[model samples]
Target: MQSTYNFWLVAISFAVATLASYTALDLTGRIFLLASARLRHAWRLGGAVALGVGIWSMHFIAMLAFSLPIPLGYDFATTACSLGLAIGASYLALVMTTRARLTALRLLSGGILMGFGIAGMHYTGMAAMDMTPGIHYQPGWFAISLAIAIGASSAALWMARALSNDDARNVFQKRSGAALVMGIAISGMHYAGMAAADFPLGAVCGAANGVNTIWLAAMVSLFTLAILIVTLMLSRFDARTTFLVGAVSKLNGQIIRLATLDSLTGLPNRATLTERVERAIQSSRRERSLFAILFMDLDGFKTINDSLGHSVGDDVLAAFSQRLLQCVRSSDTVARLGGDEFVVLAEHLASREDAGVLAESVLERMRHGIWSDSQPLQVMPSIGIALYPQDGDTVDTLLKHADAAMYEAKRAGRSTYRFFERSMNEAATRTLLIQSALHEALSAGSFTLHFQPKFHGGTDSLVGAEALIRLIDSKLGTLPPLEFIPIAERSGQIVQIGYWVVRETCRQIRRWIAEGLPAMKVAVNLSPRQLLQPNLVAEMLAIVQAEGVPCQQIMFEITETVAMQDAPKTIEMIREFQANGFEIAIDDFGTGYSSLAYLQRFRVKQLKIDRFFTNGLDEHGAEGSAIVSAIIALAHSLEMDVVAEGVETESQLDILKSMQCDEMQGFLLGKPLSANDFGDLLKHRTVAA
Candidate 1:
């Protein structure tokens, strides 16, 4: 019997197939982009169901478009089976095309399997008609139809493989064209399969009452089309989810950074280091970074505290931390672990040996760092290193192991570094043995002043001196100023020690004048605690007045660190000292991060350059000379006398003279001498007069 196809229904079926192909292909592209497994699975499952329904709707709608001399209807059971087969085939097709590397062999195999699935669905839907006389197939036409089904399936797989890997929305026209070709191939296969089926002239549908005819097909088609549309909308939402995930990740990173930084040293702690590194790994999948945790603490840092006071220790820690920053590359992370403890997070090293070299550089910088010149301070870092992956894969484990190694370095006689090992513990502590001795030594009047002469830059004649404090202990013999100063400062003894110093220096000045000797200005270093004393200016003026010495003969030197304080009271106190006739000088000028505004605010009469800048001047002439020259010119402009401390070697002396330094104090001129020796020198100066 001859049957005619309805043109409108046939066109609608093709449209449904194209829309389904476009949606499925777009989802496949999304699957390729998604790094999350859950998202990929969602798109994959949704694409399969929607595309499956669309394929089934196309076949059913096209079948309903046919008109025959005999009645035609579908059985409920068989029609449902056909729909299941279509969905299964679509799912299998999507899986094969969405592979990361879709080779020809894989595509060919997938195409064959999917072809059979589609053919089974088409033939099964034909069976749903249940023609009474029974439907037959033309042998040659049947083979040709089956061939077309397989060929079209292969073409569809090829199209999906080519276009699905890219962001299809970016190449919109190209993707649409691919979808159209796939749609035409699918429709052609369905039509050719139908052409092979023959309905006998007396045929009547046995299952005519099982399901409705054209209206049911239209309803199914509309519902499946809606599914495809929804699938496309979800693909768009997937892109938004990606953008939101990035924004959230950045905010999390910011919170970690803001929360973990140490206020004093401006370094992160152990707690947030791990979380940040983990996030880094997620964002950069390909990089395998090897980090080293150089756990360290200054060996004699407490000495800086004991002698100079905690305020100076804090400033030194801050300055040394900055020096530590400059010694390493920008990629590394530096963290302070409270007090003098610090960790350096060095990244992307090739081997454990590279971490060792980096640790060495860090140690070198800390050993020769900025300081108050008279203390003989040796606050070297006792460093311990732990490497990544081999030493530890986690941040906490690495830091812990590294700290153990650092203690090992301390035990092995500090001022050196060691790599991490399992058997490490028992750090040596010198505080218990010597801290008590500091108290006894102070009570027994062990402290004495040694004078280092400051000479005129041009005449090389002694114009003044700096009184550096020392400790002579019966138990520990003679101790360097560094040994007991930080201990004294730590125990609140430095304040009293400071008062003794002022009184003793005044007495020595009185003795020299009584001997009919020339009067010379002497600079006495004041601990920060002493500088903060409420009656400091009054007490100091009283000492000079009691000794019958002029206030100009005894100048009080506050460190550049103390001079940098912006507090109103501190500034007022400094003004009070100057107002009371005691000339104020800022010691360690280059080392302290003093600002020009603060410099102007203090209005000190003299600015002393710390040894850190002087030691490098002769060697690093271009860089160092430029800095020294700037300081001298700046000091002159402010009507302040410029003194270069730690000026050793003729080269340094000559350089200082060329720069027009007002005064120079260092070993090159003379070592610090006793009060008796200073008197004898003064006696000779009187003889010269």
Candidate 2:
């Protein structure tokens, strides 16, 4: 009973040491990685070595505490050599691309290899040990010990690798049955090897029944079997704990990815970008180094999307992104903010001229464009360049200036480059003022819609009028569409403006009905926001019903640019609006991406041809006239009414009449006026008639 208790204590002590060693290794490993950020690979290797040493020390100490009869061996060099070989082999495997993504099986293979090394070391040490008095040459002990070490190492490596790969909670869920088998196998091998260890030949004192070699072998087999069962149980418990540790590791990886990466571009997103930029900026400021910020925009990308298709455009963008990365230095950073725009932070530029030269190089590379297949495609990048300290003191200032310069490049020639100018600041200030005023104007009811008569081409009689939204800023007087529309769109204030336009238009239509005036269709332009909103359809329907107006008399005009932004969504929206009895027209048809395919799919009732083509109809004759003629013909073929916009002169109106254009609206017909002014005009038209 006392012997049994002592055995239990020894087993418990070893188990406790095993647990403690693993806990210590995990804590040390985390600290090692955290401390060695710059030399991560070297530190990680050191950490592994440290863990092995720790384990080895713990095992030896525990054994000593147990006061086992096993004596110390000479030639500890074999143990060091084995460990070194194991570490070196593992490193080779880790570095190889073929084995870089290490799996449990590979780890197990490595562990087995290490086990051989460990076993060899153990046997060599045992062989050198002075055990009792004289033991003869024991080849069996060496072979058995070698095999036992190899098996144990293999099992340990496999278990460690498997546990590291899996999450603690999920390890049991995806339990590897083979892993458990390997564990049992390793324990069985150890017991068998120990039995085979040629202990000094001695006499059996109290075996009276039999003392044959076969009986001795049978006794060893039974002993090994009992040890195997116990080993298997212990291994299972250890595996469970290993899996839990693995789960924590995987969770940490996920957190790191989320914190550092931009999900869309698969690039160092905002957090990482800021960190890198801040570091670079600080270094530059301290060292008086020159760096450049390049703000890039793809020219006419929106047109390509509205014209060719968005999918083709996405391919263009992705390809362009790759090309942009190829143009920059390895030390530089390239990031995509979103949608047709990218930013490059170039470190350690030689001078301002260097920034310009790099910008030009990038622009030149972008000029040829990327060909997806055999087809040669063309892409243009407008790059705006800003230099550190000279252009701005901070990242935000540099980026903003660079962005402005990029637009300047676009305005000058597109597919070109430009450096930041002092004048850009004034322009930005003006834009900011306009944007601020727009919000105030919306709230104070300073925004009003003007309706301009759209006359039938042949009869020259008013058919319908288009509602144009205009904001009256107290300080800025009246702001034109050109002055504020783009700003509003960028600021996301267009949605509010669009909503007001629709509501006011509907109210005016209702007023006309109340006045018993002849029913005339009124068109209100819908911005991208108005169309994209899931609840927009419902809101518009509500307005129609509340106003008690015929939905057929109300028209919603969507720009070609906005329509192509999301074709599927646009198609659904148009169908829904049409179902509610509202007429849908493709606005600014020829000005932005001309896609005949969408005309077939869009279910649009009309096409509003922009005035640029119509204004020069007489001078360019056939070329200009043909463009208009083709659009009108295309609209006719699609069963769509063509409305010519920006018609100022009777000469343009004459051309439209000859082409049999359905309707027209432009400055010549009369600029957009307030609802009250439009009401007065309607009364004047009635009196004149």
Question: What TM-score does each of the candidates earn?
Answer: 0.42, 0.61
What's the C-alpha lDDT at position 445 in model 1? 80
Clashing pairs in 1: 306-485, 306-486, 306-487, 307-485, 307-486
* Regions of candidate 1 where Cα sits further than 4 Å from its true position: 29-47, 97-103, 139-141, 154-174, 200-203, 207-214, 234-246, 254-689
Question: What is the C-alpha lDDT profile of model 2 across 1-689, one tens digit per residue?
Answer: 00011344334334433432233223222322233345446534544454333333322222223222332333345445544543453343222212335575665566556666444433332343334543344577546656666665554444444444323565543334433444344334433444444445341212123334233333433443343334334444544665677789899987888788655555666567667778888999899998888998787676566446778887777777777777777888988776778888899988788888888788766666453454444467889998888888877888899988886786576788889999988777777788889878777898878888877776766677888877788787887777788677656688778877877888897777577665668898887655656688788888778877788878999999878867888899899999989999998888776878877899799999877787769678889999999999998998889999888888888889889999888888777767777776666663212
- Candidate 2 achieves a global lDDT of 0.65
Question: Which lDDT tens digits does candidate 1 get at residues 368-471?
Answer: 75544434334568899987766666666777788878867876768788998765532223444456666676568877889988888878777888888887
RMSD of 2: 10.5
Candidate 2's TM-score: 0.61
| Global CA lDDT computed for model 1 | 0.79
Worst 10 residues of 2 by lDDT: 1-10
